[model samples]
Target: MSVLEIKDLHVSVETDQGTKQILRGVDLIINEGEIHAIMGPNGSGKSTLAYTIAGHPKYHVDSGSILLDGAEVLTMTVDERARAGLFLAMQYPVEIPGVTVTNFLRTAKTAIDGEAPAIRTWIKDVRESMVKLRMDKSFAERNVNEGFSGGEKKRNEILQLELLKPKFAVLDETDSGLDVDALKIVSEGVNRAKENTGLGLLLITHYTRILRYIKPDFVHVFVDGRIAEQGGPELADRLEDEGYDRFLTETPVG
Candidate 1:
């Protein structure tokens, strides 16, 4: 079984004031086909963990290791991590000014697979994924995320997830900026990808709305840059009702 393990991870970033720590010894394991939801308040380091796993240059790992199938992910470059079947769906996807969506997706798929996809099959897959995400065919010709709405950008992210078929995906606040219909559409896309690939997921979010569509096998409460509590889906329901107030009260922010 494929496994992604985070062991005593400590990450820091340079700010205007100076170096400030974000993750403080976060340890977790995600097995293949498992969905792990990380619910936390703002500044709780959920996004930091996602970026660090994807090997973002901005977040420096002071100590600890991220292992993918026993391979050290911390040492791998960003693209290397993707090639190794690790994917990150950014909260705020950036715009690629000149690259068309078709070209960008194909390029990324080629990079990860180490070969150009067969044009016939690749075109079919992309079109099908777009249709599944409720995206129109015209999006294929548009520049990547350029002039796209928030919902459109999110669907684009999921489109990549479905096409790339990574072993694991860290969705950093993917539910943000989505309306009810858009949320359901995006969540369905994520679920479809997981079903097709058996990809493990680390879903990070503050609200529990997304959890209704994409059920999590395990729910973790992140507070003060660490997992304060964890449980089954019932925990998410509890948090929905009680909110993060209890966690915020118990755990002081760093």
Candidate 2:
């Protein structure tokens, strides 16, 4: 079953200097219980694609359609998209100064699932997920992402993934700025979530290190705001061996 679909997606940002086109005629499809990796350089619009799919207000879809489970997601609001089982683990997680992680998780769970879990049951589940991510219990009491190291924030995102159990997840550079140990823990959490919930994943990243831990069913090379090439895991290996120079030279920007 196709869990998520993007057809000819074109996104642009309104700025002081007119609208800047980011994603240009991009198309992607992710099936249920599969892992799809979007690999590209820094400014290739990988994150833009993630945000556009997640219904980020800043990114206006000038043209195209996003469908989740056959529903038109481009017409939905951000929270509506999230409630429809689409989760985006942002590359740079925002810090909520006064909100504890526990409070944030509970509110989000209530909003997404339509009811909060029982207090004791929810805490227990959160603690277990933290343990699986090798996170300390104190993290639940702290403000969300405030004063947390890069790895800690990433792990916290995984914690939410476990708690929410979304049908589809877009991990935008979740492995960025992490050390080896932290990377393994985050990847393990993702693996466990997929195993336990059968969540489809669209992992966007520049480095191939994370792919070493979490094998992808399909790997796509994004260049010039569109998919330059796509193949099985071997595509990732080829990109690892030979840099993105070929993609850059061949794929023209629209």
Candidate 3:
């Protein structure tokens, strides 16, 4: 089974005020077919952890290690990480102006698999995934995320997740701007990916609404750049009702 291990990860970012620490020391293990939710308030280092795992240049890993299976992920480039079966769905997916969604997906699949998928089957798979996402057929001809709505972009991210079949996915606030219908559809797509491929998810979000649909096996409460608490799905429900105020109040001051 595929596994991702983050051991005492301390990450920082360079800002005008000088280097600022974000993630203090995070340790988490995700196994195949497990959904782990990292819920926290804004600036609580939720997004930083996601981007750090994806090897975003803006965030620097000050110490510790990120290992996928047995290989050290910190040593891999972003694309190399993806090829290594790691996928990250960004909160704000960028637009590729000239590349059509079809071309982009096809190219990515080819790169990841080290060979192009059979053309007929590939087209069929993409069409089915889009239809399930409620995307119009014309979206395949459009530029990647260009002129797309927030919900559309999020759905496209899941489309990639479904088609790419990554071993692990770090979905960062995928439910942020989606309406109920869109949110449910996107959630279903994520569920499908997990069910079909045994995908291990590190779902990051502030609210529990997404949890109602995705149903994480573990809920981790991130506070002041560290995981202050952890539990099962009940923790998410508690956070939904109680909010993060209690954790915020007792955060260790530096």
lDDT of 2: 0.92
Per model, how many backbone clashes are there? 0, 0, 0
Candidate 1 wrongly placed segments (more than 4 Å)? 251-254
**What TM-score would candidate 1 get against the native?**
0.97
> What is the per-residue lDDT of model 2 for residues 1-254, given as tens digits with 9 covering 90 to 100?
64788889889999899999998899888988999999988898999898888877899889998888889999898999999999999999999999999999999999998987899998889989998899999998999999999999999999999999999999999999999999999999999989998999999988899999999999998987899888999999999999899887795543
* Candidate 3 global lDDT: 0.95
lDDT digits (tens) for residues 1-254 of candidate 3 = 88899999999999999999998988999999999999988899999999999999999999999999999999999999999999999999999999999999999999999999999999999999999999999999999999999999999999999999999999999999999999999999999999999999999998899999999999999999999999999999999999989988886432
Q: Rank order by TM-score, top first?
A: 3, 1, 2
Which ranges in model 2 have alpha carbons more than 4 Å from their true place?
Answer: 252-254
Estimate the overall C-alpha local distance difference test score of candidate 1: 0.95
Q: Give the lowest summed-lDDT range of ten residues in model 2.
A: 245-254
Q: Model 1, 1-254: lDDT tens per residue?
A: 99999999899999999999999989899999999999988998999999999988999999999999999998898899999999999999999999999999999999999999999999999999999999999999999999999999999999999999999999999999999999999999999999899999999999999999999999999998899999999999999999888887786332
Q: Any residue pairs clashing in model 1, and if so which?
A: none
lDDT of 1 at 18: 100
Give the Cα lDDT of each candidate.
0.95, 0.92, 0.95
RMSD of each: 1.6, 1.4, 1.5
